[model samples]
Target: MSRNIEIEFKNIVTEEEFQLLLRTFHISKKQFFSQKNHYFDTKDFALKKLGSALRIREKQEQYELTLKKPADIGLLEINDVINQTEANMLMNHSVFPSGEVKDELHKMKFPIDEFFLYGTLQTDRAETEYKNGLLVFDHSFYLGKEDFELEYETIDRDKGEQFFNELLEKLNIKIRYADNKISRLFKVIQGKKES
Candidate 1:
């Protein structure tokens, strides 16, 4: 199984300072994780919506199934299948829900356009923290819920492809393309005001 590694930080710097930070990291604003493939982009209002979602505490495990068209983004997902007890139990074993069992129960269809940027950290257990009004998840953290707060942007397919390639190079992270599905934890927020 492939591991994901990432960290979320509050954007406290000015635009120029932020640019400088990107240079230091050898990345760009576009290289930051966002719902780039969705119909929304990271705008002020969208960020508010996402922030609201981030404030909730509905925990569960997540599962994702990616596609090919959007080179960097996943095309489909099956998220939040495990509870806390189950997660703890399955940590050391390769446990997957049976397809026949899922097929027996009619579940909601996976949202197609939704996309997320996820990276793991080096730890045995993942961690989640609410820092400076942002919900930050450490690499090993997985809550079995889907509280994705994001906006989408529209880009020409060619441009989007190029952007993904550049991002891979800038981050120095190997890019993997797959139609396989995976699991993680989820946390959903109800109606909440922005901080």
Candidate 2:
């Protein structure tokens, strides 16, 4: 298991704007990478109530469990790698891998035994360098919903905020509130269950 601080800015954008940004940055469809996030939380959304998210992301042949929580600079991300069998068990709600991640959640008073797989989100992502930062483009789909987003990752929070806003303004894109993938997926899945 490993822990780290993540500082990234995201802006919601229309598909047209997403395409324009891609073309302007000379990024092509072939450059994108794809990943799937299998999300989990207690049935009552305990993690969501705490403004945290849990997911097992499958990228290429690798699987990682990630927990994200709110922090001063950005989000504090905790990650742990798991094998295919373990990932399958988690997805099937048959097991919870024990380790530092589970220990941390237990510390937060979450009933780790109640965790369950709820939904999955897929993202086609691409990244490039801009102004000493990582510029990212994402098109994600989940629970019959799709959206496009632009992101910038940087150590300089102030410059990142400035650069992200200016870039949006230059592209004539209005910033719309974009919830993180797990939260959005949970809302949709919960609604589905209710209906």
Candidate 3:
């Protein structure tokens, strides 16, 4: 198991803006990779209510389960590597694997057994180092909806925000509301249910 603090600034961007950034940054198509996030939550969204999220990320034939909780600075991400069998069990049977992630859920009083696969979000992503931060470009598709996003991840909050904002200004992109991927997916799912 591993733990880390994630501090990042994000902005939802238009397709035109996304393309512009790619060209400006000299990011080739070959730099992009695909990853899938399989989100999980209870029927009542207990984890979401607590401002936490859980997902098993699939990339390069490997799986990692991560639980994100609010932290003083950013979000505390607890991750555990799991094999294909373990990943399948959790997704197919709602079985919580024995690890730090499950233990954390227990501490939060979440009914882990009730957790089920919420949905999946797939992203074609590329990353580069920019101004002492990790800059990310994502074109994601989920639930029949597609969007582009720019993310800057850094340990320094103030500097990261400055760089992120300046990049947006340079690109002529307005700052817009950009929810995290899980939250975006949940909103679409909830909207579908309501409709």
Candidate 4:
């Protein structure tokens, strides 16, 4: 298991803007990779209510379970690597594995047993280094809906925010409120249930 703090800035962008950023950065199709995030939450969104989330990310034939919780600066992510068998058990049988993430959930007083596979969001993403930060471009699909996003991950918050905003302004891309992937997917799920 591993733990880290994630400090990132994000912005929603239109398809045009997404493509523009790709061209501007000289990112080619070969640079993009696909990953699926299997989100887990209670029916009532207990995790979301606490501003926390859990997911098992499938990338490059490997799976990683991560729990994201609010921290002082960004989010604290507790990650555990799971084998294919463990991944299958979780996705196919709703079995929550035991590990550091499980331990962290217990510490948070979260009902870990109540979490089930809520949904999955898949993204075709490409990332490059920009101004001493990692800049990410994502085209994600979930619950029959799709969106484009730009993300800048950095250790320094103030400088990262400034650089991200400056880049958006320089590209003439109007900033839009962008929720993280899980939240965006959850919103659609809730909307569907309401309608």
- Kindly report which residue pairs in candidate 4 clash with one another: none
Give RMSD (Å) of candidate 2 vs. truth. 1.4
**Error at 24, model 4, angstroms:** 0.7
Alpha-carbon TM-score of each model against the true structure: 0.24, 0.94, 0.98, 0.97
Which residue segments of model 3 deviate by more than 4 Å? none
Question: Which stretches of model 2 miss by more than 4 angstroms?
Answer: none
Candidate 1's clash total is 28
**Tell me, what's the RMSD of every candidate?**
17.6, 1.4, 0.7, 0.9
Question: Quick one: best TM-score, which candidate?
Answer: 3
Ranking by lDDT: 3, 4, 2, 1
lDDT of 1 by residue, 1-195 (tens): 122221212112233433343455454334343221111112232322322111111222332221211114322222333344433332323232334222322232322123222222121211222212222211122223222111112233344445444544564534443211121221121112222
lDDT of each: 0.26, 0.88, 0.95, 0.93
The C-alpha stretches of model 1 lying farther than 4 A from their native spots are: 1-21, 24-74, 92-157, 165-195
Q: Worst ten-residue run, lDDT, model 2? A: 93-102
lDDT head-to-head 2 vs 3, winner:
3
What digit string (tens of lDDT, one per residue) describes model 3 on residues 1-195? 999999999999999999999999999999999999999999998888878899999999999999999999989999999999999999999988899999999888887889999999999999999998899999999999999999999999998999899989988999998999999999999999999
Which candidate has the top score in lDDT?
3
